[model samples]
Target chain A: MLAAAVRLFNERGYDATSMFDIAESLGITKSSVYHHISGKEQLLQMAMDRALDGLFEAADEVRALDVPAPERLERLVRRSVLVLAERFEYVTVLLRVRGNTEAEQHALSRRRDFDTIVTDLVKQAQAEGGVRPDIDPATVARLILGMVNSLTEWYRPRTGGAEAIADALTRIAFEGLRTE
Target chain B: MLAAAVRLFNERGYDATSMFDIAESLGITKSSVYHHISGKEQLLQMAMDRALDGLFEAADEVRALDVPAPERLERLVRRSVLVLAERFEYVTVLLRVRGNTEAEQHALSRRRDFDTIVTDLVKQAQAEGGVRPDIDPATVARLILGMVNSLTEWYRPRTGGAEAIADALTRIAFEGLRTE
Candidate 1:
């Protein structure tokens, strides 16, 4: 039911969808949707939460490990690809949210939390003299995240498995896009 | 008038913006806008074209230069930043266009032309043996473009100039975030 709602919301857009459309898709009464959860906004929030939580949790585990910053960055990329593939729909919805709704507000906050983790990693790498010091931490954070997030815009499972996509990202980002 | 129109289209949405609103913002009659342009769609398309043309032209000039791959890449990044910043509003509208309209279809074709130019640069860099060998050209292309394209979402010019941003992106991407 939740998946159906997300699909509908994505197709018609969040603002255009109604409880009636969701209930019809589920072949249940509108009241039944109420019984399952508070309402549409809550459902949207939960969907976003599911996607956002995976990112934050994966980032945390990667941060906790005792690996080199490069390897840790690689692992972070790999895990993100896996999570994005596994929960593609939910994450896609989360990306599309523009902070217009209540659920979107929370998602943005969670996004910032994830960003903080990446910022710390960049700083650590810079301190160790691997990363560049000339650029601001926040800008690098945005660039890295933007590269990964662009995956949602066009990447499909048909290109390769989650792992391959992750590996490609890591290689290109670290080694530059030249023949060496 | 143009700035107001771009803001309304970006915020409320392109489809939602009407001639009356633009005319009202300019303190002019709706017919005056029609005299300047055929209609709203023309305005949107023209705005996007102006922004995109800057990128295409800059990339062409950078490609023609005799610099090494890495330095050329740095120039590309700096010029891209300047183009985006100088034509901030038009670029913002261009970034947000989802290709949902006929004008957007044209916009996308022009976008593809721009991509083809950048892809050629990636190929040139790879042949020069400055970039890595393991990654595919297409993947790297998307990654680099994605990183730079994301600047449209948050970059403000007064705080930082094109030179700093370009240097930072080039450094992080070429050197990796890992301390070696």
Candidate 2:
């Protein structure tokens, strides 16, 4: 039922989706949905919470590693792609939120927290004088994530294989866009 | 009125918006809206079309120049950030569309055309031995765009300075995560 709601919300969007529509999608009663969850708000919260858990947990793992920043950041990118692939719909919903609702604002805040962790890693890498010093660490973090996050926007799970996507991202990200 | 619609759609969403609500926001009647455009579909198409025009034209200008590939790419990035800042809401809508409508599919096709143009440039740069040879040009094109496109998700025209944003993006994208 929850998966059905997430799919509908993702497909039709959150506000455009109604409880009745969700009920129809699941072939269950709206009351049955209420029995499973308090309301639509709770459903969004639950789905967002699950998505955040995967993302922030990846951040935590990246932070726990006491390696050089590049290696750590590479792991961050790889782990992120893995997580994005695993929880595709949930993370897609999380990324597509526009912060119009309190639930969305909460999700946005959590996303910012994760962004900050990546920013710190970029900063650490910059401080080591290994990464380019010309760019803002925060912007670099966003740049890395933008590539990874865009995967959700286009990648079909079966097309070109998962490892291929991960490999392409890792190479483009870690290596400078220079012929060497 | 279009501004209000863009603002509202960006704030809420495209599908969630109605002509009634748009009319309400502008203190005008539904008939008054028809005086301007046919309906929501035309409005969305116009807005997105303008945004695409600016982007592809900039890409064309950069391509026509005799500058080095990397420099051309930088100018391309700068121009892109300008469009994102200038056509903020329309581009935001264009980026967020899921291709559920005919107009949306057109927008997506145009977007693909733009990507292909940029990808060809990346291929040229790589072949010239300017960019990394191993990474796919398509992925690199997307990665560069990933930085600029992300600005829509967070950039506020009034709050954020366009030059700084553009410069930061250019620096991050070209120089990369390592401190040189």
Candidate 3:
């Protein structure tokens, strides 16, 4: 039911989709849909939680490592890519969020918290002489993660393995495309 | 009028927005809007054209430059960043397009053509021994431009100059964020 709701939310904008539409799509009564969740808002919150929780869990694991910031950043990127692949629909919906509702605003705030984690890591990497310091840490964090987030747009999990994509991303990200 | 339409489309999803809402947003009657354009679809086409044309123009300029493939690729990236900064709104809408309509499908096709240009550049650079050959050209192209297209989500032109962003991107993209 949640998957069907998310699918509808992704295809039709969240604001445009209603509880009745979700019910009809599922071939179930709207009250039965209500039995599972209070409203579509709850469904949205649950969907976003799936994506955010996966990301935060990855962050938690990477943070526990005693490795250098750059290495941790790389691992986080790879793990996040796996999370994105695993929870494709939820992440897609999360990325499309515009923060109009309370649930969306909450998700947006969590996303900011995630960005701060990346930014702090970038600053640490720069201090450790792994990342370049000339550019702002915030910009570096955004661009690097932006590349990862772009996967949600074009990446199809069935087409290729997330591991290969992650390897390609980290290689391009840290070493760049230029041949030494 | 088209600008207002694009703004509305960006705020509200294109499928959800109506000609009436657009006319109301502009403080004009729907018929008056029709006087200028046949329908909202035309406005969408015009807006997408603004972004696609600018990008293609930059590509054409870079194609004429007598430089190595990698340098040409760098120049195209820089120029494309400027185009995104200049036509921020249109590009934002263009990036959000999921090919729901005829205009969107046309825009998506043009976007693919643009990607092919970048992919070809990547291939040429690899053949010239400037770019790393291990990674696939198409993946490299997507990741590079994906970082750029992300500017639409967080980049506010008023915050900083596009040149600085371009320089930072190319530097990170070429030499990478890591310091030797």
Candidate 4:
């Protein structure tokens, strides 16, 4: 049901999509949607939570390893891209949220928390002389996230698998597009 | 009126923002809006065209220069970012279009033309051994664009000026976020 709601939200903007639309898409009654989920907001919260959970889990797994900060950041970047490709619709909806509702505001806050984790990793890498210290860590984090978040815009599972895309992004983020 | 419409479209989803809302926001009658523009679709096209015009102008300026391909690409990126900051709202609306309407489909096509131009520059840079040849030029173009287009998400003219942000981004794109 959440998946159906996310698809509807992605197809029609979330503000334009309603509980009735979700129910109709699933070939169920409107009340049936309420039976499982209280409302459209609830479904949005659930979908965003699902997307955030995948990202946080990936971050946590990378943090658990005793790897150097650069390697850890690379692993997290690769995993986040893979997670985004895996949960494309949910993440797309999350990224598109404009904080018009409390549910969306919460999602935005959680998204920032995820960003802070990456920013801190960038700082750590910089301190260890693995990353360029001249650039602002926060800026680096945003640009890297921007690159990864862009995958949601054009990625199709059929054309390029998550691993291949992740590998390409990892290479670009660390090694850049220039060969000496 | 188009500026007012772009703001309303960005605040409320484009599908949800009615012509009446735009009229009300601008303190004008709906008839006044119709007198100047055909309808909401016309406003969307105008706003997107404005944004694309800025980017294409920047690209054209760089292409006209006799500089090397890498320098041309860098100048284009910097100028494009400055243009995005200067015209934030129009570009934001341009990026968020979902290709649901004829105007949006046209906007998407123009956007792809812009992307292809940048991709060609990347290919030229690679041919000159200015950029790494291992990654696909299309992928390099997308990632670089992903980094630049991100300015629309969080950039505020009052915060970091366009030049500063552009400098930071150029450094990251060329030298990367790493230190030897």
On lDDT, the candidate that comes out on top is: 3
Fraction of reference contacts reproduced per prediction? Answer: 0.59, 0.48, 0.70, 0.56
Over B8-66, each residue of candidate 3 has an lDDT whose tens digit, in order, gives 98888787799999999999998998898999789889999999999999999999999
Provide the TM-score of chain A alone for each candidate, in the order shown. 0.90, 0.93, 0.96, 0.97
What is the per-residue lDDT of model 2 for residues A90-150, given as tens digits with 9 covering 90 to 100?
8888998878799999999999988898889878877776766667777777767887888
Whole-model lDDT per candidate: 0.78, 0.82, 0.91, 0.88
Q: TM-score each candidate.
A: 0.89, 0.89, 0.96, 0.94
Docking class of 4: medium
The DockQ figures for the candidates are 0.54, 0.50, 0.78, 0.68
What's candidate 1's i-RMS value?
A: 2.4
Maximum-DockQ candidate: 3
True contacts kept of 2: 0.48
RMSD of each: 2.5, 2.5, 1.6, 1.8
Clashing pairs in 2: A130-B178, A130-B179, A131-B177, A131-B178, A131-B179, A132-B178, A132-B179, A178-B132, A179-B131
* DockQ for candidate 1: 0.54
For model 3 chain A, where is the 10-residue window of minimal lDDT? A171-180
How high is the TM-score of chain B in model 2? Answer: 0.94
Residue A64 of candidate 1: its Cα lDDT? 90
lDDT of 3 at A178: 85
**Candidate 1 C-alpha error for residue B157, in Å:** 3.4
Pitting candidate 1 against candidate 4, the one with the higher DockQ is 4
lDDT: the better of candidates 2 and 3:
3
Cα lDDT tens digits for candidate 2, B1-180: 778888888876787799998999999999999899899988888888988999999998998999888678768878999998999988998998889899999999999998888888888887777677677788778767876798887778888688887877765566555543
